[model samples]
Target: MPGPPRSRVSCAKCGEGVNDRREVISVLEKKLCRPCAAGGYYEPI
Candidate 1:
């Protein structure tokens, strides 16, 4: 099945499109996918 189109802005960590997804991670004032912000290894804040 085809996903909901593709967008330019994607999550830096996850690589998923941050297009239609409302609940995106706005890190550094930028947009990111849910998984990118929530999952993955952590370094520091």
Candidate 2:
């Protein structure tokens, strides 16, 4: 079965695609991805 419909959004800083399933952060009235919201990318383990 297919998953839920995607509601794609763009991050204010990087313009990365964000979907409804992923976590979205709002800052200063702009939508941001997790990395952007966290102020940087995560280091790989």
Candidate 3:
């Protein structure tokens, strides 16, 4: 059996194209890259 399909999504803030779907983080209903996700620049609601 196979897992979910791997798709590329662009980061909301940096606009960087995320190659791995797992690496993308969801914030404020938006998808972000690892740096944008782990970085302290964005505030949690």
Candidate 4:
């Protein structure tokens, strides 16, 4: 048997789609991704 379906969540700040529930951050009743929650800073690659 298969498990329940996974719900897709998006970040309120950057509107980025978050695939994993563990990576979602809830702030002020809004869902935010890791980068957005961390002030949206992307390190140079």
Candidate 5:
């Protein structure tokens, strides 16, 4: 068996991989990552 091909969507702000499909695109900027969009400045991982 195989899995679906990964979709490549770069972060609007950082130009990095979002890693997941964002159902709704942010309008403040372009496509922003979860953290960027959420404004999570320093959330402990």
Candidate 6:
């Protein structure tokens, strides 16, 4: 059987269009792409 449906969402940092099934990371309630998410751009303001 197939998994859940994938939703289209843009990366909160880079604004890249990606599917939910992709390797995305959520930080502070925001969805980010792998590159941006791993880039350590989440610096406290």
lDDT: the better of candidates 2 and 5: 2
Better of 1 and 6 by lDDT: 6
Please, what are the lDDT tens digits per residue for candidate 5 over residues 1-45? 157536658887777676547523687647877777777678667
Q: Give, for candidate 1, the lowest lDDT window spanning 10 residues.
A: 18-27
User: How many pairs of residues collide in each model?
Assistant: 0, 0, 0, 0, 0, 0
The TM-scores of all predictions, comma-separated, are: 0.41, 0.60, 0.56, 0.58, 0.56, 0.55
Candidate 6 residue-wise lDDT, 1-45, digit = tens:
267546777888879877655746675878887778777656659
Error of 5 at 7 (Å): 0.5
User: How many backbone clashes can be found in candidate 5?
Assistant: 0
Deviating ranges (above 4 Å) for candidate 4: 1-5, 40-45
User: lDDT per prediction?
Assistant: 0.61, 0.74, 0.73, 0.70, 0.67, 0.72
Better of 4 and 5 by lDDT: 4
After the best TM-score superposition of candidate 3, give how far the Cα of residue 33 lies from its true spot, in angstroms: 0.3
Candidate 3 ranges beyond 4 A from true positions:
1-5, 40-45
TM match of model 4 to true structure = 0.58
- The number of the candidate with the highest lDDT is 2
Estimate the Cα RMSD of every predicted model relative to the unseen true structure.
5.4, 3.9, 7.4, 4.3, 4.1, 7.3
Between prediction 1 and prediction 3, the one with superior TM-score is 3
Q: Is candidate 2 or candidate 3 better by TM-score?
A: 2
For model 5, what is the error of residue 31's alpha carbon versus the real structure, in angstroms, after optimal superposition? 0.9
**Candidate 6 error regions (>4 Å):** 1-5, 40-45
Comparison by TM-score, 3 against 4, better one: 4
| Error at 30, model 4, angstroms | 0.9
Q: Ranking under lDDT, best-scoring first? A: 2, 3, 6, 4, 5, 1
Which is the better candidate, 4 or 5, if ranked by TM-score? Answer: 4
* Candidate 1 TM-score, C-alpha based: 0.41
Q: What pairs collide in candidate 2?
A: none
